[model samples]
Target: MAGPVILLVAAFATLVAALLFGGGAAPLVIADAGPVVRWGLPIVKLVVNLAAAGMLGALVLALFALKTGERAFDLALDTASVSAAVFTIGSAVTGFFTFVNVFNAAPSADAVFGDQLGRFLVDTELGRTWLITTIAGAVITVLAFAVRSWTPTLIVALLAAAALVPMGTQGHSGDLANHDIAMVSLVIHIIAAAVWLGGLLLLIVIRPVTDRAPMIAILRRYSAIALAAFVVVAISGTVRATVAVGDLPSLLTPYGGILLVKVAALLGMGLFGAWYRLRLIGRMAADAASRHFWILVTVELALMGIASGAAAALARTAPPSETAPAFVRTPAEQLTDAPVPPELTFDRWFTAWNVDLIWAFVVGFGLFFYLAGVWRLHRRGDRWPVYRTVLWVLGMLLLLWVTCGPVNAYQDYLFSVHMVGHMLLTMAIPLLLVPGSPVTLALRTIRKRDDGTRGGREWIMWAVHTPFAKVVTHPLFAAANFVASLWIFYYTDLFRWSLYDHLGHEWMTVHFLITGYLFVLSLIGIDPVPYRFPYPFRLLTLGGVIAIHAFFGVAIMMQTGLFAAEWFGAMGRTWGPTPIEDQYIGGGAAWSIGEIPALILGVTVAIQWSRSDDRLQRSQDRHADRTGDAELEAYNARLAAMAEKDARAGR
Candidate 1:
């Protein structure tokens, strides 16, 4: 009770102070919505942010920290439900206020005003975003209250996270130079912050009802989660600030100052998290230190409030970066929302860079976790093959390059480069990644939890063994999916979607990677799956896939028409090959460069098949040696009996 009250009071106070300091609520020169609307909008938005955090955080922590069917788990869900209700109301109110601010229309009983408001919600992009957000919030509110089990609760949590997406899209990213990067960073920042802040709030709520032993255990689990959240929050925050501030000189501006205050609050919270992780969590197991832990928690919540306030105020403060230029610079720039790069030279293939922060993080964390797993095995006197580690590192590095390097840098303008990235993502990288046998490493290294609560190890096990996993990892299905993906993605509107939408591009990357990984894993991976094809059948599957894959590429090469002509053809690239020529090159990449890896896979499968036969023959020879050819004697006896029966018949 005291925690929530204290947090809100602190948040409101700081929001008011920051708004005044930043002139966020100052009178606008044009289309001013008056003092009440200006002040009221930010205040309502702040409430929405807090409510979102509480809804999502409680659900996430409940999934990770508390055992199902327990009082603590139920209480966490209850908290989520209550918070979701608040979120639903807050989102609706925020939407109305936004409409008022944008249209400067007063709430009234007139039917004309009603019709206009209805049109605004239906017709405008901003209105649609808010309406969707409100609907998602309302859905989450019901689901959170109705569901208490693991899977259902998890679904609700995901929905709650999705509800935040509209807000992320509504931010200043649309007006920024690095639109994709800014949008992605803001989304990550919002979700991570929600999880961190909401989890702590959940802990505070469930403390009174939970046993001391379980409470401490939950605290320890949450500390791990908080640490991860902090890293994401910090990185995303840095990216957001870098784009928003433009240059160091802008740091002295009002938006920058408000951002600095938020940074300070985050730093303070990080320190408090470190203390709790290293020392306080352990001490809290004892009665003497429990009081101290709660006290510190209160202070940490206050700091979170300050951050929340500063963030809300920052939203209202215009960045020093020049507003998105009014005039179009070029056709490419108009379409891509970015300037065209210099000519595509041979050297640019190696030297060019365009960082996709999402993949960069994925690669970073993937390497870190994989190496950590291997290290754990070594420390336990187990010898994980060194080659696996090397291969995994190579795969991750290649993925990093494909996603964040030259291929990514030029893919938007050059169809050939996009195909190059696709090949690497689907074929080359998966070839290396499968042999690394990441799942095997994880199963061998990650400590299993005896507690009923699900942890990383438990979740991993659950995922791999699920019915859906069985279907996807089946050799025939995986191969079919792998072959079908290339044709489907390249031939459909999905191709255009990937070109025009950042999320769609990310989806393509992940979808291809997974399909390829499943295919390879079924063939030659060391990780255990529900089933694997026999070596001969595996080769047959590979052969079928290669034929289909080649035909798809040939179809593309033979086509006179270009895919996504509006995008690829309209890129206005002067130095690169013509769009049709680039498409041909892309088809060549798919057929020629891509087939090299597929052939490699085929050869590897053949080798494993031969080795399997040799191993079986050795086992039989060892049996003969141990049993002195007993099977041979039995065979001879049976033959002699048949000969004696023939002799008797002749007599």
Candidate 2:
């Protein structure tokens, strides 16, 4: 069922991508691109996205009912519910390709396309065949959906729909008069929607906290659902672009830039999710703080939404606005004087970092190996490192402090460079830092154990395992690192200042790395912290933070005026330097309108934590109920008596 759903999504993605990228059309082909897009494939994506969204909404509602044993939302869920979420995501993917087809460049042939899609598009034998295909597919899919519950019907319908999208585009190769209505926006929207749908399916199959029967078996089923979703998200995304755009420059265009970001975020989410499911979900079985899985799933779903929906809007916009001016009337050609070469500045140098060389070739990962191993050692007995761990950490901190200049300088205006900096400080560093066991080291370093301390182990344990620690390590606080930083830096003067002044820049880098690292750690549960908040609190906290952060990005995009700091403006690449388009893409990503992707991410993390917590709670309960362990009880009783006698003697 899951496989077929995915295949349908793939078919739709392929058709849309082919039209968008395969020399489809340029903005010149359609002056008023909005309506063409609105009527065309965009409508198709909208249908799929809306359907997928309905399914997810239903799933969430059903989950609530199941958990609480309530009947209130049953009708709504029943009406919306499809047999399988995995199928919905895949079918929705076809909808996305249909979405891309909407923004085709048919304005040049308005006499044929204006309020009349059946005109030039379906006039020819090829066009007529394509139209027939779409009608046929939509009908068959509906029939199939009725016959077989969720997944199978969705696959058939979606596959048929996918074949119809490219044919809807009214143009083909060598038809330069016709433009490609298939926008990046539409493609992104479809991808994001699929992820959202897939994630909801994951929720159904996963270990439902509310399930009272064959609980473990149910969890295994949930895992399978999540796996299906994961595969669909990846496959659909890949196929869409492969068929959409043809060349490297197309990928580099402003339209493509946004697509790149969405894809990157998806990739990151995928890698992170895989790690949790495949590796550490079990080790955390006894930890109380594992409930963060839900929070991660939520965030992942939300991000996916922003990326996809923004893409939908982008689909309606003109072709790459940053392309070479159609008619170049340059004063440089008129002037005989040789232009003086501008002196290269620090920002220029930093922005020009060949990431292939630095991030790929010279990551300096050895520091992590040594640092994490040394820190882990600190978790054990009184063995201090030959050298002080605090001093070592402080020194590494100094090295990172300098990353501000290099990282910031490398990203003049490109989002990708900025992303690299984000990755380093956030994802890579924190993963290593937690394993190094910074929290435990601080404790060992500060306390002198042999110095007549009463209730030493108990006191230390209590502080280490406090509610406060768990809360800080929770996914909510960690997401604050990612979501909040993006808001603070991008939407305000903070972004400019972080790159302008030395100190501000330093702190910016510092905060970025710390937050990023911490967020990942909190999700994964590698290190222990001081605050241990419950799952519900973490989910709400992270969700709220993500919404606010996404809003800030949206605000920046919606504005018509300049937003970058004064210094940034002086440097020539202000917020409004480019057409409001790129900003729009970024904003959409920030808004998380790509649909339910972030939610999925939040849930993925949350499930892992829940599974861990459930296992631990059961373990502790077993140990606590050991009425048959007479020797262990006797040992404790004897120890209690000896302690009493020792106190009396001292008195």
Candidate 3:
């Protein structure tokens, strides 16, 4: 109780001070919106952050550590319900203030004001965002009150986390040069911060009710989660700061200075956590040490308040220009949010670079966990195939290149380059990934839980055995999905959506990768599957898929009109081949580069089939050796008996 109260007071004081000193209050005077809307908006948004953190963090702790029917678990849910109620109120208040701030309209019950407000909420992007966030918060508030079980509470937590997305989308990044990257970074940062902050608050709240043993266990689990959150927050914060500060010298600016304060506070919290994990947690069993632990937690909570408050102030501050010499953008730059590069060259494939922070983290975490899994196997004197590791690493590297390199740089403008990336994601990368047998490796390396608690392995196994998995992994279904997506994606509005929306682009990548993976898995994968077609049927399926794929490519090549002409044709590019010619080249690449992986799949399936036959023959030979060819001898005896009966009948 003291910890939370102190945290709130410290945060509020810091926020007020930063706003007055950091130029955040300038808007009130400049816009003449008065103190109520100006001061009230940031304060309400701050409370929204704190309450959202409490709701999400408490739910995370309950899911991971608290047992059902336990006092601590029920109490945690109650805390979540209260926090969600506050979140709902805060979000609503923030939404209303955002309207006043954006429109500079004083609050009134007049029909004119109401009509304007209605239009703002229904028609404008910013208004719609806050409206959605408020609605989501309301839903979570109700669900949190009604739910006490693990799964239901988990759903509420997810909803609560998702509710932050709209707010994240409206951050300063939306106005920046790297809008997509900024949006991704801000969203991840918000969610990770909530989990980290909320978990710490819950720990303090439940300390009195929990026994020492259970408390320690809960602390250990939370420490692991917090460590992960800290890493995400650190990386995401750095990415966001780079965008916000723009250059090194800008750090002396007011906005940058406030950001630095937040960074320093984060560092202090990190150091405190390190000391707690390394020096204090081990001694927590002692009465004197436990007393010191509470003191340490109080100080940590104060530091967290400082960080959160500085963050709120930083949000209110204006960022430096990410684009230098701000000038009118060309149509190409307007569409892509970046300048057109030099003419495409062979060397440019390796030289061109565009950093997508989201995919970078994905690749980094993927590689780290894979290597960790392999190391776990090695330390236990278990043998994992070396090729699998190589293939998985290679696949991830390909994924990184496809997503973050030249392929990503030109995909919006060049149809040929987009096709190259699409083919790699769908065909080449999955060829390597499926052979890695990641699922088998995970099942081998991850420990199983016996206490009816869900863990990584349990969740994975559950996913694999679910009815959805069964249907998706079926050979005929997988083939149909693979073939159908190529048409549905390109011919329908999905193509336009993917071009215009970053989220849709990401979905397209993931969807293609999964469909390709499933197709390959059904054909020649090393991992155990729910079902696989017979070798002959597998060959037939592969052949049919190849034919359809080739026809699809041919259909594109033969088309006279350009697909996605509005996007690809409107890039105003002067250097590349014409859109129609580029589309032809893309079709040719699809027909040619795409077949390489299909050829590999064909040969792999054939080799496996031959190996299957050889194994069967060897098994038969061993049976003959053990039983002296009893079946063959019995057949000969029957022939002799028939001959003897024939001779006796003749006599």
Candidate 4:
């Protein structure tokens, strides 16, 4: 019944989405009416979004159940996830065609496409559809599967943030501020909903397996968490609802009517939660009325599902963007235009990318070679195939040289480009490189040839696996790397001025890559280190770094007011923000929610620390309690006496 009911709701939603969005897309075939002009795409996208969220949620539940080994909470999470998966997969399939016609066909940066592409995306329904799906995917996944552990928390948090990406400028919503607010509120809603609901799942499942006496302790801690989650859901939800509904009259409107239904569902969930906690749960805990608890939680889960489905629609289907892309018929109608194609204007970046096309392939194949070598060594643990390793090194050199060419030619744009480049190099490259352990593995191969550790890879290992390595690998160091780099570059204009000149620009790129490499290495934990810290410290440091990052963002945001730097103004009005507002948002982004990443880090570190501590403590306790033969005991006693004698003598 639960399965069929959820599936029916999902199918109905998808059908409504199809009629409104995809069916409407037939208008796009006209020259003036590409998909960007259609309504069907957005509707289809909404359906896809719901489907994906539903599917992923189900997968998460199934995994949780397996881990719990058939606990009731596990079973419920599994059930809820099943429902979620239905919605998610259905939405994804329905939305895939739209994404194909939208972001894929729509206009992208010239580097990716031409001006016509941008026009198609900006002027059409296709862009809207893609934006909605991307953001929705990021959000829904977080809600469903992001809560397995700290690891999942980190993943989900990141995805939730990603959901806000399209809401930025490219989101074409023109209301970045509103979108920002919605995104933040939505994130709060998801975290609160998952924690609160997931806990209910846990409370129901665990209580049955454990004794009632322990329930008090468990419930005491969990209830506090659920309470906090409830408060967040209530406050943020109210704000979200208010913004979404726009006014009281909306309740009577068709769209508003759906929203009301969703709200009612959430309210029902809340009521059920109250009943379980206030009336039924206590008695259920004391007595053996576990079935009643299950029944109530399932009801809550069902309500949450309904509410989430409505929210999925409301979140992305924001009543059309207020800001429309302004295209000028006259070549000089004077809009904010990206600077490129000095010789001639092209449709998109890719349109003029004869040179870039070749470069892309070069980089792609080179990376493939490097990866193949890495896999071979890791799998075989030998240098019998030595030529591939050489090719790998040469390929890296070639890649660096290729990048160097652009570094010299576009020195003027280096600073801005450097920021973008750093993000890619640090984020994309090292994670792949380190996991292969090429450096270490290569060293191992070299050492075997010499059969000694005088000056081979063994020595390299000694250096990397040393105290300094340990220190750098510490949470403190990673935090420092993440925070200090930005402040050093931006707060002090040394980084700023450095990128403006040709020579300085070259050095800037170099530094950017090196720093990024270290930062990511520390973050991804690919390299080995001995020093460690506790979870509490890890969390604090993570929070600290986020706080620091937020501070920089705040400072940049504030620059919108009459601050120094003609460069900012020269970039045009849109490029530069008012110092005060920019500073506020920058800091807000930095401080307001930056702690999320840190919280995740702290959890990871804490879990590791806890496991290690437990193992060490247990080992020590076991060793102390060891039983042995008489002779061994006598020998130990003699050694103790000798140690006592030596201590007395020294005193």
Candidate 5:
């Protein structure tokens, strides 16, 4: 009780101070909205963030670490429910205040203002964002109250997490030059911060009731989570700062100063975490050390408050200008919110770079966890293949390049480049990734969770055994899905959506990667599955897929008209090949670059088949050695007896 109260008080005080000094309410003067709205909006938003953290963090801890039917677990869920209720209220308040702030309409009995409010909620993008968020919060509040079990609580937690998405989308990202990256970074930042803050609060709340051993275990688990969150927050904060400030000089400005204050708070928390991990946590089992731990936690909570407050204030502060001076806008710039790059060339493939925050994190975590798994295996005297690790690392690196390098830079503007990326995502990258056998490694390394809770290993096994997995892993079905998606995506509005929408692009990437992985896995996966085709059938599957793929490519090449011409043509690129010619080149890439991976898959399947035969023959020879040729001797004796009987009957 004391800890939470302190956290709230600290958060409110710092938020108020930051807003007063940061000029966050200055726009109210021009908008003619009273100070109540000007001041109330950020305050409500801050409370919303805190409550969200509490809801999400408590649910995550309950799912991941807390035991079912335990008092601590129930307490955590109750806390989540209460937090969600507050979140719902806070969100509604924020939305209403936002309405007042944007329209400068005071709350009154007038029907005209009421109509305007109704219109704002339904028709405007901002209104829609808040309305969706508020509704999601309301749903989460109800779900959290009704659900107490692990899986149900987990679902509620996911719903709460999803509720944060619209808020992420509505951030200052749209005003920034790197809109997509800013939006992604903001989303990651918000979620990670909530988890970190909420987990700490839960720890404080449950400390008194938990036994020492279990409490220590919980603390250790949470420490790892907090460390991960800290890293994400740091990286995302830097990206956000870069987007908002634009230059070093801008850091001296009020907005930048508030950002700096937030960074400082984060740094303080990090240092405190280090001390807690290295010094305090080990001693937490000692009666004397408990007081020290509580003191440290109190200080840490205060820092969290400061950081959260600064974040709320920073949201309201004006970012530096995103536009360049005296720069003429191109059609691409108008559509994409960024300037067009130079024409694609061989050199540009190596030189062009766009940092996709999402994939960057994906690759980073993939490498870290995979390597960690390998290290754990080694520590336990198990020898994981070095080549598997090497292949996994290389595959992830290629994925990063495909997503964030030249391919991503030019894909929207150039059809050929888009095809090149699509080929890599759907074929080349998966060929490497499938051979890495990530599932095999996970099954071998990740500890089993048997407490009626889903952990990494449990979830992976469950997923592999699901009906959807069985259907997808079937060679014929996998091949069709792989080939059909190409036709459907390119021929339909999906391609245009991918070109125009960031979320659509992400979905395209994920869909292609999964389909490709399943196809390759059906052919050459090392992990256990429901069924795998024999080598001959595998070869036949590959052959049929390749033939269809080639025909699809040829169909594209023979087409006289451009695909998604509205998007690629309208890019207004002056230096690249004409849109139709670019489409021809893309067709060639689909036909040519796409074949390389098919050949690789064929060769891999052949090698695996040969190995399978060799292993089978070896096993038979070992059985012969063990039996001393007794079966062979018996067969020869039986043949001799049959001959003797035939001779006697003839005589």
Candidate 6:
């Protein structure tokens, strides 16, 4: 009760103080929504943010740390359900306030007001975003209350997380210069903060029902999650701030000042976490240490409250550079919300970079975790192949390059470059990734828990053995999906969607990468799977897929018209090939450069097949040596008896 009380009070206190200091919710001189509407909006928004964090974080921790049918698990779900309900109400109120603020609508029971509100909800992007968010919150509320099992809870958690995304798009990010970067950063920031904050609230909520030993265990698991969440939050928040603030001097502005306060609070919380991880958590099972731990936790909660409040205030405050509305100066800027890059050159292929912070972080963490796993194996006196690590590193580096380097820099302006990236993502990178057998490495390295809770290792194992995994990893299905994705993506409205929507582009990248990885894994992966086809069948599958892929490439090459003509044709690129010519080069890259990886897969499979046969023959030879050729003698005697019977028949 004290902890929760302290958190809420501190949060509201900090929020009011910051809003006053920054004049974030100050009444507008030109289009004033009155003090009540102006003040109420940020307040309601704060509630929405906190409720959202509580819902998503508790659900995620429930999945990762709590055992099904346990008291703590049920309590966590109850917390999530209640938080989701608050989130729903908060979102509705926030939407109403937003409508009032944006349209200067007065509170009324008149039919005209109702009609206008209805139109706003259905007719505008802002209205639709909030409507979707509110609906998603309602759905999560019901699902969180109803579902106690892992998979269902996971679904609810995902829905809850998605509900936060609409808010990210609503912020200054949507109309900003680096819209994608800012949006991605905000999305990741909110999600990670929720996990970190909500998990702590869950601990306090569930503390009464848990024994000390189990509580400590749960705390340790949560600490690990918090560590990861904190890293993500810090990184995403930094990127987002960089985008919004624009320059270092902007830190003197109202928004930046509030942002600095939030950063300080976060840093305080980080220090508290370090203290817990390094000293307090280990000794907290004892009485005095337990009391001390709770004291520090309370302080941490207060810091989190300050951070959260400052964040809400910062949201309402305008950045230094956003004093005027963004205006598009060209077709390219209008289409991409960005200026066109300088013409692509051969040197730019290696020198240029347009970093997707998402993939950059992904590659960074991927390398770190993979190497950490290998190091763990070495420390335990276990042997892991050096070649596997090399391949894995190469694959991750290629992924980073494809996602963040020149391929990404020019992909929007040049179809050929986009195709080259697609080829690498779909075919080349997977060839290196599959042979590394990351799953095998993880299983070998990650500590197996005796407790009922699922950790990374347990979850990975569960996912690998699921029925869905079996179907997707099947050789035939994987191959079909791998080849069909290329056609389906390019031929349908999806191509245009990817060009227009940042989320769609990310989805395309993920879909291609997964399909490619699955196909390669089915063909020649060293990782354990539910099923793998025979070597000869694998070769046949590869051959059939190769033929179809080549045909698809040829089909693309033969297209007389441009794909996504509105987007590609409108780029206004003057230095490079024409749209049709670039498309031709893209098609050629698809057919030729892409096939090299397929050939590599085919060759690798052949080598594996040959080795498998050789191993079988060697095993038989060892058996023959142990039996001293007695089976051969018995076969000869049987043949002689058959010959004698034939001779008798002839007489």
Residue 611 miss distance in model 5 (angstroms): 0.9
Q: What overall lDDT goes with each candidate model?
A: 0.89, 0.45, 0.86, 0.48, 0.87, 0.90
lDDT (0-100) at residue 202 of candidate 4? 48
Q: What TM-score would every model get versus the actual structure?
A: 0.97, 0.31, 0.93, 0.41, 0.94, 0.97
Report the Cα lDDT for residue 523, model 2: 52
RMSD of every candidate to native, in Å, equals 1.7, 23.1, 2.7, 20.4, 2.4, 1.6
lDDT of 3 at 116: 92
Error of 4 at 88 (Å): 7.2
Q: List the residue pairs that clash in candidate 3.
A: none
How do the residues 214-316 of candidate 4 rate in per-residue lDDT, one tens digit apiece? Answer: 4554454455466656766776677656655566866665446556666787778777767767765566554556567656666766666566556545533
| Model 2 poorest 10 in a row by lDDT | 332-341
- 4 versus 6: better TM-score goes to: 6
Write one digit per residue (lDDT tens) for candidate 6, span 495-521: 998899988999999999999999999
Per-residue lDDT value at 75 in model 3: 81
- lDDT per residue for candidate 3 within 60-154, as digits (tens), equals 88887777788788888888889988988988788788888888898899999999988988899888988888788888878887887766887
lDDT of the structure predicted as candidate 5: 0.87
Write model 2 residue lDDT over 1-651, tens digit each, in one string.
242243335434533453354233334454434434444544354344545444443343233222212232233233243522333444443333333344453334556444354452355444454445445434443443353232333344355334333333322211211111122222332433443454344443333333433333223334444554555456545544544555567877655655675677567566756665565345334344245544454555544444444344334333442233335332321121112123335555434321211122112333453465565556765575554455445434533432534544334343333444554454445544544454455444433334222122324555557676566556656666577677667667777665543335546766776675566555544345654446666666657765765566557667675545233223333333243454455455445432243464367569967897999998777876776666678999999999999999999
> Which residue runs of candidate 5 sit more than 4 Å off their true CA positions?
27-29, 109-111, 322-328, 448-455, 633-651
Structure candidate 1, residue pairs in collision: none
- Give candidate 2's error at residue 376 in angstroms: 8.5
Q: How many backbone clashes does candidate 5 have?
A: 0
